[model samples]
Target chain A: MTINKELMKGSTVILILTLLDRKPMYGYEMSKEMEKSSSGVLTLKEGTLYPILHTLESDGMVESYWSSGEGERKRKYYQITKKGQGLLKEKQREWISFRTAVDQVLGGGPA
Target chain B: MTINKELMKGSTVILILTLLDRKPMYGYEMSKEMEKSSSGVLTLKEGTLYPILHTLESDGMVESYWSSGEGERKRKYYQITKKGQGLLKEKQREWISFRTAVDQVLGGGPA
Candidate 1:
């Protein structure tokens, strides 16, 4: 199924926060994890993902640091901050409310 | 709950179509119904709602006409077009897929 670009755009911050909530990750690793986790249903492009990362960082929702893991070249890894976590919780709530509202109207209701 | 403006922006079209799918509605009526039905989780301002309606009208997903019913003054009412219905189905599928993918990562799974 074709993913709605608009919806994806709206959920970008939450998606990034959700992934980073587990552990810190670099951009490529994060995108790969998202693809795998979504079972290829949501493949995020680097172009689409990086700018958003930068925005999140600037917004103080996320922070970045150099990571030089064993046998791997140094890369910038992103992690959600305490502020980010709170924002993530807020976002999650909003998503749930929006989903419930939409489902109520779209699902088994008077038609 | 604080509704994410970004997320709300993304789902505006879907929400409007879902309501219009039930029956034709005017601007004020649509906003009121959305607030009432969402249990006030979403309170769409007329300014925010109208621009979206205009965009949808331009996209041909919906059409508008002047309606005068009973004692009410003439008002512009909107209804979903065939294209809009097709789009609604696509949006529904996309929302489901997105929600499922999100649930997988956010739920009690490998962390």
Candidate 2:
């Protein structure tokens, strides 16, 4: 299916926040994790995910540090802050409520 | 609970696109719809929602037209385009996959 730019642009932020909530990870690791976790169903491109990472970092919701691994390549790892956790709760609440509303409408109630 | 800015910023786009999928709505109407649909759980502020609406309109995912309603209010109504529909489908798929992954992790299968 064709992905629309508008939808992709809007949801990128929440997706990143949600993923980062799991643990601290670098950009490449984050992208790989999303792919592996989604079983390749939701592959996040570097082009799309990096900008969001930068944006979130700038917003201070996520903090980063450099660390080297097996390959000896230094990579920046990201961890969600206290503020990020709070935001995740809010997003979860909102998503549940939003889905419920859609279900109500789709369930054949008065539109 | 205090909502974090990062999470809000990230999910705002998907929220707007999903709401618009229900039917054609204007900015004020969209904000009101989110509030009403979420049972006041998710309120969309004009400050945040309008810019998104503008961005979506510009991106061609949504189209707008002016209509005068009661009290001589010339409100611009927005409707999702075919491209937007494609986007909604992609988002739905991605969201489902993303949530499933989170569930697996939270379920303690492997962490």
Candidate 3:
């Protein structure tokens, strides 16, 4: 099912950090990997991806470096920093708590 | 744990609708019940609560009416409309899909 954009907004940073936590990847590669792994459920638009990346970089959560690919294409690759990893862990914990909280409300009805 | 406000933004509507789905409640009652049922994990601030209710009412998802509670205090109670229930079901499904998607991305790593 297509997710609401507003709902999707909260997840973008964590998603990016999770991907980078695995290995460094350029923007297009990360986007494709997310879509493929999620079975097209989470499509990160390029426009949205770049700004978040920039923000994360500014916040020192991630760092970007330029590298030349096989086709001599220069791409900016993002790698998770120590700070990013820490934030990723925190975000993961928060996500679990948030999910559980939401489930509690959704299932409990009125109390 | 206190959820990040950004993450919390996406869930307010679903949470509010879920409560009303069980029974109608005034603003304060709903807020208190949400905190109680979630064991204080989900706290709905009154400021954030009213605007969403107003939006839901305007969108025909919920309707509100004033009622006299104890001490003869008039309060506006909100109840879910048919449209709200429909939206709630859809939001629930989307939430599941989203949770699944995030899990896929988080666990699969570089796919």
Candidate 4:
């Protein structure tokens, strides 16, 4: 599925954090896993995911290290930082609350 | 609560459509109603809402008309066009599916 761009915007951090919290993975691997695990719901383009990964690293929400290997084998692997984990929890809670709020409105506001 | 910025970005269209679908509303009214209905989960600044509203109008998903009155009383009210209603249904479905997909990943993939 082509993820809605707008929803994808806000969900970037949580999704990254959620995936990284499982295990460290390189960008290409992360991209593939996002699609596979999500049952093809999220397909991350390199252009979009790279910048987000860089920003997350700079923000200290994630950290990356070059794998020790020859040039052809080397790749940057990202792991969620402690801060990222905390934010992930918060974002998850916020997501649930946000969804409920929208439902209330769609259901015609407060009962 | 201050919404997670990214979630707000993706949710912009649906929120606007859902509210305007109920009845015609001016920008200010829509902004206020967004906060009220979402329990303050989403707060749209005029800068942000204006651009999206304009985009929706340009896309023919919605239409706006000025109230026939004095300058102070005149305000442009937006209503979701038929195309918007169809889009709304599609977006709502995408949102639910997206949420479930994320949950599947967060739960550590297939059981």
Q: Which candidate comes out best when scored by TM-score?
A: 3
**Fnat of each candidate:** 0.49, 0.07, 0.71, 0.68
Q: Residue pairs in steric clash, candidate 1?
A: none
lDDT of 1 by residue, B1-111 (tens): 546667676677778888898988999998998887777777678999999899999999999999867997999999999999999888887778877876776662436
Which regions of candidate 2 fall more than 4 Å away from where they truly are? A1-110, B1-3, B69-71, B109-111
What digit string (tens of lDDT, one per residue) describes model 3 on residues B1-111?
678888887778999999999999999998899898788888999999999999999999999999966787898999999999999999999889988998888887554
The two-chain DockQ for each candidate, comma-separated, is 0.50, 0.15, 0.70, 0.51
- For residues B4-82, what per-residue lDDT tens digits would candidate 2 score against the true structure? 3433444566667777787788898878776666565566899998888888889888899998777877888898899
Comparison by DockQ, 1 against 3, better one: 3
lDDT (tens digit, per residue) of candidate 4 on B1-111:
776676777777888899988899999998999888878877888999999999999999999999997667889999999999999999889878877887777778322
> Which residue pairs clash in candidate 4?
A6-B10, A7-B10, A10-B6, A10-B7
- The Cα error of candidate 2 at residue A62, in Å, is 15
**For residues A47-68, what per-residue lDDT tens digits would candidate 1 score against the true structure?**
9899999998999999999986
Question: Share of real contacts kept by model 3?
Answer: 0.71
| Model 1 CA lDDT for position B107 | 62
TM-score of each: 0.84, 0.55, 0.93, 0.83
Listed per model, the TM-scores of chain A against the true chain A are 0.90, 0.79, 0.92, 0.87
| Clashes found in each candidate (C-alpha, N, C closer than 3 A) | 0, 1, 0, 4
Q: Which ten residues in a row have the lowest lDDT in candidate 2 chain A?
A: A102-111
Question: What lDDT, from 0 to 1, does candidate 2 have?
Answer: 0.67
Off by over 4 Å in 1: A58-61, A69-71, B58-60, B108-110
* Per-residue accuracy of model 4 over A1-111 as CA lDDT, tens digit each: 677776777777778788899889899998998898888988888998899999999999999999997667889999989999898889889878877876777777422
Q: Judge candidate 4 at residue A12 and give its lDDT.
A: 71
